[model samples]
Target: MRPAMLIRLALLALLVAFIVTPETFAPVFQPFTKNGAPAIYTQTSLLSLTLSHLAIVAVATVAATLFSVGLAIIVTRPFGVEFLPLSRSIANIGQTFPPVAVLALAVPMFGFGPIPTLIALFLYGLLPIFENALTGLTNLPGNVSEAARGVGMTGRQRLTQVEFPLALPVILAGVRLSVVISLATATIGSTVAAKTLGEVIIAGLLSNNTAFVLQGGLVVGVLALLIHDAFVMFERSIARRTGRLY
Candidate 1:
């Protein structure tokens, strides 16, 4: 009965419509199609494209999360503190170069398809997660660490038990940002022969099929919103459990 519940239901219904009966929504796109053209984007299944898009983003996000969080942890440690600036510079390099450029440069070595796209997405998604992980690890309350040390906890134990739990919410915030950004950016992968919603948009552009463009754009937009909302909910849950408020 809550607004949140209703919104979730609505999103679920919309996703089902897109997956199960995309044609049911085709009529709305009729104005975009040419006089003699089909009003629907029929070259590929929207569901399949959506799944592939999410899979690419998921893999890239996972890779970014591991590398960024690991680097952040390493640079924050006593042994590796000196490398903080270098790590930061490396992470920033990805953001400095646009994802499109990364793809362009990567394609030469990686060849066309998802590999180049994966590399671009992985590089592009690193900064926020890295920064957030660094902040979370470095900003722990002094007393907490002292208490952890006083309890005869080893450095590893303190890190795993006392520090990480408190830092998880902040880290999740970064991941949320990374994921949403990756979702939007993943569409560009189609330019390099990767299968994505962007393929539909590109086809529409080349053939002058407005319906295809609209359909692809709408699907991608809806997916981004859906995934973002899911992350928002997850971040909130983490914050609440961690005794933090976003």
Candidate 2:
């Protein structure tokens, strides 16, 4: 196996160990404790919180990917070319406001829980995926696009069989960014009573438990790194098969 892959595996193993036996890792945080008690984040299951965190990010990222890619595809087509600016502006709408603000606004309508967080994450993740999709769809070499047309492929056929496949790596690059960002950002959902690793971090902050904060941050950071590396590997594999790189 590659060195990077080995490192990722090691990290995954360590994360699992920490989550499964958080008490074993308590000594590491003991020095950072404010109270005389042992520093361990035992109030909730670390594994469960981590799973909830992943679930929220996964849902939001998938939703963002679908919307962004669809809009990108629409705007790239001849009939939809006129709407490019409007689509872009719409995509940018999410980024123009902070996600916290979005959450604050959504809470009134969605009530406290994952719904508001979901909306905030979905919107926060849109711009990267949309921009990458736009770039991928628009940057195809002229001859490559012409060759698809020359083959008498229908618009749909050309798109599905040629353009989309060729553009997928670039689109996945955006997805990588979106997923990583969402994983880290989703922690904020805990502020509104949504279950996330942020709950640990917030508890730490509120009670001066540095251990809780560190544990939460460490888990989120490792998860992000692992997912980012996974996407990089995937993109590289696709690139190799497509002759995008030797």
Candidate 3:
């Protein structure tokens, strides 16, 4: 609705158009190639690569969200309170290790392709979601919680109806961070034979073709920016609906 958001949407549209029909702008990339060695990557369709890349990120992020949010909820419960440290440790393992390392470690068991990449991304995206969920679940206003208890609400009822609704915006903030991180990191999935935009960049790097690299990087960077902005808008809407924002 705002001018800035409209501008970003327009730019994203142009980038998506470029990815879909790169040959239309071959002349622009001509300078980046040598001896007319194809200014665009043609080994695989960039649109297909982009779609596959998104699919991988979507799947991984969903898995990470479920696991991390579940674990956070558990640790916030009375019976599971003592295991908070252990849960944090488990979530930290994902952030502590590099995605590449996770891929290398997973490849031996999962073999090449999207499986390893999914494992890497799923692990890499856990910490932010877990941390945010934990913070949201634990930091409720005391009086609001008391009101929930006073209303003949059981612990489960309070959690499902009162606590979680209040905590959703914060939890979604964590998910936004994880999704953006996973978007960038998912590029590395190409190294393990996964179909992604990284294939374009990797091909460029291998053949010393900057044009290919630029195409891949531009798409991924713009996609990340657009997704980040969308998440911000969604979070603000949620905050307003929850009366966290005036």
Candidate 4:
């Protein structure tokens, strides 16, 4: 079988095992338990935080997309090559910063709750967004760009009409990456008392209750997969409907 096919099969097996494993449905998988009346409200209470985390991710996606695309455009010119070094440096720097440390630092300024989590996720989300946007813009077909220029298309017109549309696939691929990372990291935000499904996992950890952790983790993992699939569907639909694909 082809390597890609094999890999896909393996991934499917892994996903199935994770979902079907006995550990997933255990009422309580460990030596701990929530107090009586803890009920399912624990999970419900966390919904607000989870939504807040997603909100931050949305904000981050929008803000980072604009900055990244703009930065890509700026750095593409010969006169603007100087910005390339700076852009690379900043992108690298952002990735190197420990996300938890960024969250901790934000706490003093933002003061508890979800704000710090948002800022950390925002910073963490930028590198991929910027890098992908930069790559997509740079790798655009030269003939297409030249054709536009030959027709007397202004720089802005060429960018909007030719470059940007063709670059969308690559750019969206980066966005898909950011979305997955943001979902995973939102769980970490629970450590900072930020609202999210992470609350389930953390609560389970603190009290040594595996069931809660599994439940929260299972929900989160499924949600991440669903979101990833949604993006794939969206990207494919765009490609087909736009005639980017045959």
Ranking by lDDT: 3, 2, 1, 4
lDDT of 4 at 155: 85
User: For residues 119-182, could you state the per-residue lDDT of candidate 4 as single tens digits?
Assistant: 7777777788778788878887788889999999998898888878877776787788887888
Q: Ten residues in a row with the worst lDDT in model 2?
A: 237-246
- Per-residue lDDT tens digits for candidate 1, residues 192-212, read 999888888888998999988
**Models sorted by TM-score, best on top:** 2, 3, 1, 4
Candidate lDDT values, in order: 0.88, 0.91, 0.91, 0.71
Deviation (Å) of 119 in candidate 3: 0.4
Cα-based TM-score, every candidate = 0.96, 0.97, 0.97, 0.80
Off by over 4 Å in 4: 1-46, 241-246
How far in Å is the alpha carbon of 178 misplaced in model 1? 0.9
RMSD of each: 1.3, 1.2, 1.2, 5.8
lDDT of 3 by residue, 143-244 (tens): 999999888999999999989988888999999999899989999999999999999999999999999999899889999989989888888898888766
Measured by C-alpha RMSD in angstroms, how accurate is candidate 4?
Answer: 5.8
Q: What global local distance difference test value does model 3 have?
A: 0.91
